[model samples]
Target: MDIPVRAHIERLLDAHASDGLSEAVEQAFRAVPRHLFIPPVALACRDDGPQIIDRDADPDAWWDAVYSRASIVTQLDDGATDIRAGSGDYTCSSSAPSTVADLLQRLELAPGHRVLEIGTGTGWTAALLSHLVGAANVTSVEVDPVLGAQAASNLAASGHAPYLVVGDGALGCPERAPYDRVHVTCGIRRVPYAWIEQSRPGAVIVLPYCPGFGTDHALRLVVTPDGMAYGRFPGFASYMTMRAQRPQRDQPARTDADKHHLTTRVDPRTIGHAPAGADLAIAALTGLDSLGQADQDEDGPRYRLWVSDPAVPRSWAVAVWRPGQDEYQIYQVGDRPVWEEVVAAYFRWVGWGEPGRDRFGMTVHADGQEVWLDTPDQVIGSEARSAC
Candidate 1:
């Protein structure tokens, strides 16, 4: 006998009932057998941490993983690498059940509303949408052909026949125009205007808004008759980026022979101590990426905050704070003093009363998107050209 998957679903629903999981979503969870969509071997289960489950190697572990409240990495390196090998960039996944439930509740789906799903990794979400609406009303698009085919097989096995499209999800499926709701599973640095254009005037568009920073939050936008979609971010979520908008890894340039050095009394740790939405604000204000590392120096253990400009190669800066030091040392290279910009952004966030993610909103227009703190008229930053 195996562990009863429905039992696990009940437990999951109970755990998240107060966290916005709805009765309709609970019914869908009980209806879908997640194990059917997952491959038999080498499942990546993120319980306390990441654990690999090989069915042949350990059947019990595989079953537990299949039912666990964790996101399973279905494909890595865009399906180029074998799962048995055990290590690569996660390209696609079946999202954690709790995450799926929350997003579904936020969507506010009706009985016959048409939904357009971006990033049909395992078709689990599509199946759930089909359960809410009808299969004929769901259009799921996957960028990878292999994943698309696999998802199609999984959906068919589960007795669902949603319209599955194999193409660039960024472009969306226009033939099935004017979706009632647009739900994107993939994280994107920039929200594509095409998603808004394909939605009905009152349609809701939900997606993970990742500005290539510390964390991502779900952005819920409502399309308007004026050809714009605008709304606030409810909470945090981190998803893999759409392939087309994925950022290339740019290593810091070699030490500049003429590097500039300075010192600040504003302890480097202060910059690391971020308020609610400070990281997102900093990323938007300076257009830079940041990381913090703890290491030992000649004197003692030190904390270093690194800031780099991903778009401009060779631009980087580091601020180091050591024990008993009143001031932090800063070293900067390239044309931009990234550390200074980060510090300035931190002050700006502080000056704004340290607002949370809920206070932040996004507006997607025909030309581009704008991020605002409290209102659209007070735009913090705008990206004229989206990578997508």
Candidate 2:
């Protein structure tokens, strides 16, 4: 049953080989049985998004989902929610085949090289790494104990055995230090210095950088001899945040109701429509999390932007814009001028030629991480320089 589906996936991946997919990764996909790693009733990958696939309820749909180029959500709300009940928050998933292939290709793995993988959600990636670098050279760490044990079982069933550690993935597995490559399967707001410290100089570290404003991007950093990791974001990616670094979803406290109102000629949509790099720039500059929503008003369409510090609840800002309006209304509270900083970031991004994620890179030093555009000398904002 798995043979034909595996072949079809391999063919699809091979078609994309010219676009960065490598033959080695294609072979790894062909050899591994992804279904073995997922739950009996799990959400299968689909073009539109994830759809539930219950082997007992619908076998054919389940098979198709296992073979589809989509990510299978294995756990919801960190395993607290009942997926069988219909809806839940996505916590862990078997990443889409194409995404996994892309990350592996970017890794540029070689035989006999030691690799450390963080966030072994379902163990499919670990199996692929084992196939590429031999099981003895692969070490995978998972933050969830249940997921770790399940991954171990799945790997054993697939006849591949890799070192599996059940602990926080943010702190890379030091038991196996000096790894040649480190691949993280989760999104992180801040890249842990421990990952750089654990890797050998020149080792490559790939992870999804999600600063919580726009979409996440796959950041590829190479460990430097001077105990720093620096690299550029190649493309956009979406992954679950590490357990420890997950954003607090709580709404900001409504303590300060004395909101200062002001008017700005800058349209909110301009910043909203800006490239993902602009969001990264805003996050770096303001050091604040932003959320945007759209709705219909009596006048027509309306958009609202919320910028606040999740850690420090005192400072928050809101900007409201309506279509055909030249001056947008802004309400700011606390010491920080959140909306003003966002405007500054937008102009700064445009001043630097409005570069894409590829043109932007990050340097993670002992002092702090600094986001740079085109070159490391040009830091994103004055705040980053002072923080570093």
RMSD in order of candidates: 2.6, 2.9
* lDDT per residue as tens, model 1, 69-184: 77888787888898766688888888887777777878999889999999899999999999998899999999999999999999999998999999999889999988999988
CA lDDT of 266 in candidate 1? 80
TM-score against native, each model: 0.91, 0.90
For all candidates in order, the CA lDDT equals 0.83, 0.83
Candidate 2 minimal-lDDT segment of 10 residues: 379-388
Give one digit per residue, the lDDT tens place, for model 2 in 163-191.
99999887788989989999899988888
Lowest lDDT 10-mer window, candidate 1?
1-10
Q: Flag clash pairs in model 1.
A: none
Clashes of each: 0, 0
